[model samples]
Structure formats: structure tokens, C-alpha cells
Target: MSDRIDKSLTRKKLDKTLKPHWVWAIALGSSIGWASFVMPATWMGEAGPLGVILGLTLGALLMIVISISYGVLIRNYPVSGGEFAYAFLGLSRLHAYISGWFLTLGYICIVALNATAFSLMLKFIFPNFIEQVKVYEIAGWEVYLTEILLATILIGIFTVLNIRGTTISGRMQFIFVAILIVGVLTITIGMTSSAETSFSNLTPLFTPEISALAAILTIVAIAPFAYVGFDNVPQAAEEFKFSSKKALTLIVLAILFAAAIYSLMILATGVAAPWQEISQANHAWGTGFVVQEVLGTGGLIVLATALTMGIFTGLNGFLISSSRVLFAMSRGKVLPKAFSNLHSRYNTPYFALIFAAVIAIIAPWFGREVLGWVVDMSSVGVSIAFFYTTYTAYKLLKWSEQDEGYNPELHIVSPGKKVVTLLGMIASVSFLVLLLYPESPAALGMESIVALLVWIAIGAIFYMIRRKELAKYTREELAYLILGKDQFKLKKEEE
Candidate 1:
């Protein structure tokens, strides 16, 4: 593993061209996609606008705590694997592989989810274009051949875009995110000004039937999915062309920004469309209907265009992040070395991007209903990764306090931060459990649970097969593999 790292360093490196703001763009774009437009209806249906607001508020607070822990970890390590790197450093190789597996699953699911979302967005905008092409039926939902083809084409396009280079993806992310923000703001302003929309629509803001705690918990359970992309900052840490402080600041800002965007989307939907109508309509097109009502057909087109751009940004960002995670895992010897191979010209993990794209291309065939199950299951995986990362952060803080060579300047792990991480772990685990509840909004049904189990089982088999080979490397060797010898040397000098 160490030899591979040393050899690779001479061949290529992840480009260090991304500034702090570009990092923010990736995070923001990875989130705030079709999910932002679609999910609020579910939240608003279960709870009203006020309930949704409260849920998002509490979820944001929890995500802030998680982000702070991530900021500290990334500041110290500044590696591409994000949680996988942290776990390898603070815990063990086995722990790191497990974290990487779950995180990778989440990213792949997001890629697939967003591809399907893009197709759905098109369906909303042009309802008649492909309505006649029925593929199959699953769980009472009709699967369309055209939708599957569109999703596959999208996955292929995004895979190529990502394989081209991180610079191209980052540039695309910024443009799309800018359009999304402007579209959202325009919709909000227009909706507020329209006489058709009334403040009275916000009446009975909280759900009359559901308790506040339950409503908030519902949103919190799915919040991981909504906020998953902010952590992409850490996954691209090696590519950042800025100070660690700036990177950390941008990460926090991205979290806050995404939370605000999600909340505002919910507010706009509630204000622009009647709660009863939104609740009864297909949650996927609920926001579209709101836009149509508030801004007419022209505004709906603009919003769809912006969301389509958002889908591209999201797919690009996740591809960038997921490939890095695979590259790091491969470099660490947990997976095959082929995954770590960067394109000669692009300096991106081309093999890993294609691997993820293959998954995205095939996933849509299961139909959107099953994909929803996959998305929820992916959130559970993400929460598990979050819990492990937070636990590792707390463990590292304690270790730093005891190690004589530990330098406070290199790592920011205070007792207060430890407490926050501990809280984050609890929240993460609670959400994981909540996601498993049979009646929870994002609950994993039997089929989804079986699918998740099968995925983990496959990972377990691979781990068993590679366990002996992976065990050849000592912790020091593993660290060198992940951080490179120069970084390891710098850490030693700092300590």
C-alpha cells in the first residue's frame, strides 16, 4: 500500500485548483437538487409549514454539530476520503473500510436518485412527451421506458463530465447553483407578491393530528439525505487551493446555506400552494404545481430548467466525491488498486467514476418507487457513517489529549467539541433507528432492507477475502498510504 502511494505520487495527483468558494459550490450543488423541491411536500404534509420549519431548524442544528466535528477532522487530515480517512486515522482499517462502504453506498444512491429525479422533473414539465411508453409496473407504480432511458443517458453524461476533470465539474456546479439560487429567489418573491397566494394559507401551520416531536423527528430522520453533500468538501480536501480554516469555514457556510435553501423551498411551497392540494398531490411534482400557480407556465419552465441544472450539479458533485472515496479506499488496500487509478490527463478517478455510473444506469430500471426505497436505505447508511465519524472524532480528541507529541495547533479537539461529537453520534444513531421503524416516513421496507443487507453482505465477503492482504500493512503504513509520506512527515514535525 505504501509503495503504491509512493509510485502514484510520481505519476499524478488530484488537482489543487479548487478555491474555498468552489468548495461551497460543490457542497451547495450536491445538495439543493430535486430533493429540495420535492421533499418539502412530504414534510409539509406530515406537519404544516410551521412544523416543517421547526423540523428543518432542529435538523440544521444537529447537522451543524456534525459539520463542526467534520471541520476539525478535515483540518487535521485534509484528505480525500472524508469519514473513511478519519476512521482509518482515529480507529482501525476495518472500521475505515466499513465507513467507506456505507458512505460509498450513500453517494451511489444519491447519483441514482438524482438521475431519476431529473427524469421526473422532465415528466412534470412535459407530461405528454413520454407518457405513452410504459415499461412495467412495480408496487402499483407504472415504470416508463422513456424515463429509464433518460436516467441512463443522464448518468452517462455525468460520468463523462466527471471523468473529464474536477475543474470542469466544479465550474459546472457553480453555474448551476447560481441558476438554482436565482430561480428560488425569484419564485419566492413572485409567490409573496401574488394575490393568489395568501398569508392565510399558512394558517394551522402545525399539523393538527401529529405531535411536534414526531413531526420534527420525521424530518430529522431524512435530514441526512438532504444534507449529505456538504461533507463532499472533505472528500475533495486534497484538491482544495486554500487554507484549512477557509475550507472549514466554507463547509460550515455550505451547511447553513443548504439548510436555508431547503427551509425557504418549503416555505415557498406552503405559501404558493394550498396545503391540502400539496398534501394530496404527488409529492414529486408538488413544488412544480406551486410554481405553476404562483408564476404561471413560464415560471414553471424556468424553475424546471434551474432544477435540471441542479440535477447536473448534484450528479457531478457526488461523482467527484464518491470516486475520491473509492480512490482513497483502494489506496488504503481495502479495495482493488485499479479503483485508485487516475486518468493521465484529467487527474480524476476515471475507473471509480465509471463503476458508480454503471450502478446509476442500472438502478432506474427498478422503477422510481423502488429507488425511493433505495434512497431511504442510503440515508440509513449515511447516518451510520456519520455516527462512526463522530465517534472517531471523540476518540481522537481523547487520544490527542494523552499523546505527548500532540499539537493543538494541528488538531482542534477540545472537550466541548468532544461533547458536540458525542451528541452528533446520538443523533445519528437515533435517526438510523428511526429510519428502520416500519411506520416512519422514510422507513426501509422488506425489499429495501433485503437489498441493503445484500449490499453489506457483499462488502463483508470482499473484506474477508482481502483481510489477510490488508492486514499486511501496519497502522503507520496505512497512515502513509492515505496521507502520503510528505504529509506524514509534516505531522511528525508538527507534533
Candidate 2:
């Protein structure tokens, strides 16, 4: 039911109205940004430096591989489907629906988690002022004058920028990205300057202890959450001056930048604090404590501020992407039509955005762990989606229709694509196992399994509800929907 949104709201193409940087801003924001502050802080506090490193490594590899596979997909059909397009073009409609649900749910959780984190951090940084002005509960348990006011103000800021238009939001992200780079560089160099970091720490060893292995895998499970921003490339496709090859360039560049940056920060975090403190991060936060310890109150302040900015941008990025998914789906007639309405003045997926925003923010309350956990579980969903897609790509390459974009000979002999696709497949499947392992130090464990089951069940129900309408649409419709109709029409030559 991916592209098969309700008939009245059938899948349609996006308006070509954005700059290329907007694409990079949102995609890169989701892909890496400043999420580093959240993880190793918790991990460093609870597990150890090794656990934090392992968690980051796992997430990065998973995201890179999965995103690379998606990169190949979007290169062929650059548009806003995200997983919706991936499933619609490569796999079953049911699978596409599942992908949509996973990404949607994952990002919704991100928004709420970020908002909550933002509120808490603001209170932490400026306790007295936030206190006197409070109007809501602390972590949903106790009321406070300051926290409420802070949450209200921040949300309002984000909402206004979002509602005003994409241009304003894009500019905001551009500014944040500058700040993000400074914070990331500062943290990385600060940690690097300290004596503990060594090439020795990153040396590979396969001998895995039961405890170490489980902890490593668990942390790794959540690791993919770190690299999820690749999907945003497709979300920004409508804005690109060129459509074809847009997806390929965007994904590759985004991944390389993110990987290098993350690798640097991870090494820095390790060097700044001992393995013992970084691992113990599971209790209060994660490795953030060590950063505070080493960087002094000033460093901590910068990181916390960076986290706040990163989380907000990440939240906004997802809200933007998820709405497009729904909008495309609604146009396809797989779901209700009301989801596709755009605000004439805002030129945004106004209703879809607002609806998703409200739901995304409040939904995290039900979950055991809000932000990272939600993002991790979403990775689980995408893992399933990627497996389906890689298999689909293999199958499509083997026997796809001639007129469509299938390349049978390339699958076997295109060594580079073959290797990357295989890597993508392995990385995805590995993350799935990591998420399920009970003893993982990253803490996903069996609960992740339950989360996956619940999300799948929900997705299944949604698919079944829309099956009848979707059945009428043939592969031809699916193809057009995947490759935006506007994309096929080349611009008339300006004489």
C-alpha cells in the first residue's frame, strides 16, 4: 500500500521548488548532525568506552550499507518515496507500506524524544529561570513552570519556521549546520588532544566474549540510527535542478561526509575518556558525561546546545520527509485522501505535516525508551525493507521488464554495484540480528523484537485495510508513481 494512498489522494509528483543545499541540509542533518552527544554519553556512563565505540560502529555500518542500497534505488528514480518508492518499485506493496510505517514511526519518535530532551537540557542548563516559568510535568511525571514554557517556546519556534516555508527552515538548518560543525570539531579535537586515544583502540579482533559480544551487538543494533539521514536525499529530489543521477550523487556524498565525521568524533570520544566511564553511560545519559568532564562546563554547554540544535533539525527533517511519504501514498490511493492536502500559502504538506507532528511528538510517551530506542527500532523496520529491496534488486536485475529500468547483465558483471549491494544486504541483516540479541550492551535486547512485532502488526493492519483499493493499480501505475510523472518530461529546449 505504499504508493496506493486513497483514490482521492493518489500518489503524485512533488513541486520543483527547492535548492540543492536544502536537500543536503535535511539529509545530512538526519544522517549525522550532532547525535553523537546523546549516545556515548549514555553508553559511556553505563557500558564502557568499548561499548560506545561498538555501538557507533554498528549503527554507522548499518546506515551506510542500507543507505547505499537506497542510493542505487533513488539514482534510478529520484523522487520523494523514500522506502515507499523502494517498496513500490522493487518489492511488494505490503513491504512498501511496512517501510513507510517504520520510517514514519521512527521519525515521529525522534521528534518527541528531541523535544523532551530539549526541554530537559534547557532546564538542566538554566535551572532557575526554567523553573519559575514552568507549566508542565518533568519527564511527564512532575509539573514545572520553566520546563513547560521552554517546551512551548521551542516548539513554537520550530513550528513557525516549518509553517512559514521550506526556505526559512532550510536557512535555519544552514545556520545550525555551521554550529554543528564547530561543536563536532571542537569535541573531536578536544578528545583527540587527550592522551588516551590511540590507533590501538580501533584495531580489529574477532574473538568475542559472551558479555562483550552481546554488549557490542546490542550497541551496534542502535548504531544504524546514527546513519538514517540518507533517505532525506530522495525527500529533497523535487528541489534538485537535475533529477536523474540526483539520488546517486546525494547519497554517496552524504554518506562519505557522515562516515568521516562520525569516525572522527567516535575516536575523539574514546580518547577523551577511559573505556570504563564511557561504558557506564547507560545510567543517566551516555558518553556525554565524559565530554563534560574533559571539555569542562564550557564544552558540556556547547555539546548540550549542539544536541538541542541537532535534535530539533533532525525532528524537522523527519517531519518534512514523512509528510512527503504520506502525501505520495495518499495520492496513490492506498490510504485516506485527506492526508495529501497542501497549504496553498505555505506550499507545504500542511495537514500531513501538522497531523504527523502532533502524533509524532506525543507518541513516544508509550514507549519504554523514547528517542534512540525508537530510531533503533525504525532501523529494524528498514532492515527488513532493505533485505526485501536488495533481493528485489537482484531479482529485478535477473528478469525485469525490458522497457523499465532493469539491467539484467549488470547484476552479474557490474562488480562495483554487485559488491556494494552485497555489502548493503549483509549490513542490513547483521543489524537486525544485533537488535534482537538479548545481552547487547546498547540495550535493545528482546524489547526490540517486541517493538518490531508491534510495528509490523500495525503496518499489517494498515495494509489489509487498504488492500482492496491498491489491488486495482497495476505495475504500470506503480512505475509512474515511483518515477514521478514530471520527471519523465524533459524541459523544452529554450531556443
Candidate 3:
């Protein structure tokens, strides 16, 4: 083979430093951030305790099915940018750009959400220590200069850590996640063992105002945000030291584990006191207040510790994922080429990391309440990416069977596999409708809708600005840049 052919086959850029456990930690950490800690009461308020369990379980099952499509694509392509690379190869460059843009929005929003959540956690623990120096107010929530500074400092620390390399960040993720799990388990045990707790406290299981089905769908609608981290597995496929076949198992496990943690937190919150009372209380952090109410100072301390770890893991994991997506898009010429450049010693996407961090740092200035609006909007973005990925897998499988010249090494050749991807597509679409449809229980408010529209408009304008430059590259050249010339050649050989 010529040197050109040799260069095409190898992925010598990003270091393969992620172990199986680190990947799992990243997925679980990303999925179980501030929402799991602070929003249990909100979920209880929306659907009641039983509704929270039902919705999260159903949502997780749906995600597991969707992950099957991700598994298929990762095994076949195993590139960074996850769905971005899949859509580019199985669909078109336009589809790829759409997927990358929305997914990037979702990941970056989560990163900012976690950073802002850090201040909220501190407020609950110290009660105005970090809430000093009020800067402004938006949407009934005050934006404190101290909070912004604290959040910015956290974002800056993670940015430098991530720019150094993945191995360091990955190891830290594993440790933080382990401590977080212990903290959650401690809370669960304490709540269950307490004399003040009772299963009867979970009465009026579903909210009377909404139908039970609607209540369940409410949680299911935001499942994309709740279970966002598992897809990070695909985003880091290029950095996997293990077999791509393992990606599916890791993704599924992460989703299931995250679901359990969410359920436990809700359960602990419910049994600690009359969940209805807690739901109705004027507490800023309902779960925190309830835990502290029943278990006192000891309980509050444990819960605070867990919340801190959850925020850290979220920041670390999402930074890694968001940067990788940008890097992959840049390498494929979907974005500016500077983002594709890796650090000399770290072998990491330095420019992309810095860019994501800057966006996250700016988010706190908008006030913590406004970040929630962006997060709700970002759920729609993630759903769009999920649809594209599942649809691409379905399309690839159909082509393989119908075209005499096409055959890739699919692990499971069962006729039923296509049905899974089809179901995934349907599920993905349902989540989107539940979020975007006004009649749906989980529909976004006007503010969130405006945010989503603004993001879409910005993405469209940015793509048009880069379209002419991207148009200059042939499909083959783009494929070589994204999939590695060797991998692209191998794909051609299979076809």
C-alpha cells in the first residue's frame, strides 16, 4: 500500500486512554447531575412519587432500545462525533451537520447547567454565602455576581483539566462518581431506616390535576435530558481502548444505572416526609429541605456532598463529550478547521475545549433560572440527534439487505434488529412531540420555545456562512477526513 493508503487507515490523533469503567462513569455522571439532586421535588410535584418511578423506568427502557441503534453504528464506524459521523456516512453531509449542531447544543447546555448548579448547591448548604452581591434578576430569580464568579471559576478549572488530557479527567470522573453513588446510597438507607419515614408518605401517587398518562409522559418528555450521558459513549468511540462491540453494553448499563439513581432519590425524598407537603413547601431545593427536615444536619451534609460530586462529574463528562463533537465536525470540514487541531502534548482537542468552556462560562451571567430554559430547549436538540442516529442505522441495515454489493459486519443479523431501530425512531419522535407540542404535559414554556428557535436560527446562519467552504470538498475527501482514509477505504471495500 502507498503511504497515502497507510495514512488513511490509522487513527493516530486522539489518545485511546478511556477504560471501560471510565466510559461508564462518564455516561452515568453526565446523566445524574444537578437534576437528580435538586429536581426530585419538582418531579414529585408534576407526577407524584409513583409517577416519577413509572416515567423514569419507561423512559430508560425506551433509551435502552434507542441505544441499540447507537451500538450498531458505533461498532461499524466507531468514530468520534458519534451520530455526526453516522449521519454523514449513512445519510448526507447536510443531515450530519444538522445532527452535529443540535447535539453540540445539547451537550454544551448541560455543561453550563451543571456549572450554574454548583452555585445553587452552595446556596443550599451555606444559605447566602455564595448568594452575596446581587447583580440582577431574571424570570423571578436573582443573578448574584458571587454565583457567576463561582460558576465561572469551576468552568475554568474543568477546561484546563480537560485540555490537559482525557485520562486525567476520566480517572477523576470515576472517583467522583463512586463517591456520589455512595452518598446517594447513604441517603436512601437513612431515609428508609428513619422513624419519620413511611411508604404511606407516598400517597396520592399521581397528581390529581393531570391524567396519569399525562403525568408519566411529563417525565418521559425530559428523558433525553435526564439520560443524556449514555450517548457520550458514542461521542468517545474513537478514544475507546476496548472493542466497539462493548459500547452497546456500556451505554445500556449507564442508562439503567442512572435510572435507578433517579428513582432512589425520588423515593428517598418521598419517604422522608409527606411528599405532598414537601412538594407544596416554599423550599428552594425541595429534596434538600426534606432530607434536612427528616434527617437533620447529618442528612443535609450527606446530600450536599453528593450534590457537589454530581456537579463535578457533570462538568467533567460533558466537557469531554462537547469538545469531541466539535472536533469531529471540524475534522469533517463542517466547521472551522482550527477546532480540529489537537494539543501537541495532550493529544486533545484544545480549541474545541476552550470554545465549549467559554460558552459555559458566559451562561451564568444570564441567571441560573434562564439556564433551565436553555436546558429544556436543549432536550429538543438531543431528541433531533437521536432521531437522525436511529434513522441512519435503520437505513444502513435496509441497504445492506437489499443491495447485492453491500455487506458490513453486523453483529446481530436477525431480521428483528431493524424493528428495534424503527421503534427507536418512533420513540425518538414521540419524545420530540411531547416536548414541542403544546397539548403535551411536558411541553416547553414560551421562554423555552423561544430559546430553541433562537438556537436553530443561529445554527442555520452559521451553516450558511460555512456552506461555500464546505462545498469545496468532495464526499470522498470529507469521508477520508472524518472516518480515516483507511477506514473509509475499508467501508468502500465492504460495499
Candidate that would win on lDDT:
3
lDDT of candidate 3 over 43-68, digit per residue (tens): 99999899989999999999999999
TM-score of 3: 0.94
Query: Each candidate's TM vs. the true structure?
Result: 0.91, 0.80, 0.94
- Superposed by TM-score, candidate 2 places the C-alpha of residue 270 at a distance from the truth, in angstroms, of 4.4
Candidate 1 lDDT tens digits, 21-88: 77899988886767887777777888788877777777777888888778777777777888898777
- Give the poorly placed runs of model 1, Cα more than 4 Å off: 1-12, 398-413, 437-443, 485-495
TM accuracy, model 1 = 0.91
Error of 1 at 185 (Å): 0.4
Query: Between which residue pairs do clashes occur in model 1?
Result: none
lDDT of 3 at 235: 91
- What C-alpha lDDT, on a 0 to 100 scale, does residue 303 get in candidate 2? 76
What lDDT score is found at residue 374 in candidate 3?
A: 89
Candidate 1 Cα deviation (angstroms), residue 15: 2.0
Stretches of model 2 off by over 4 angstroms after superposition: 1-11, 45-51, 54-62, 128-153, 191-216, 243-246, 263-273, 278-295, 364-373, 396-415, 437-443, 485-495
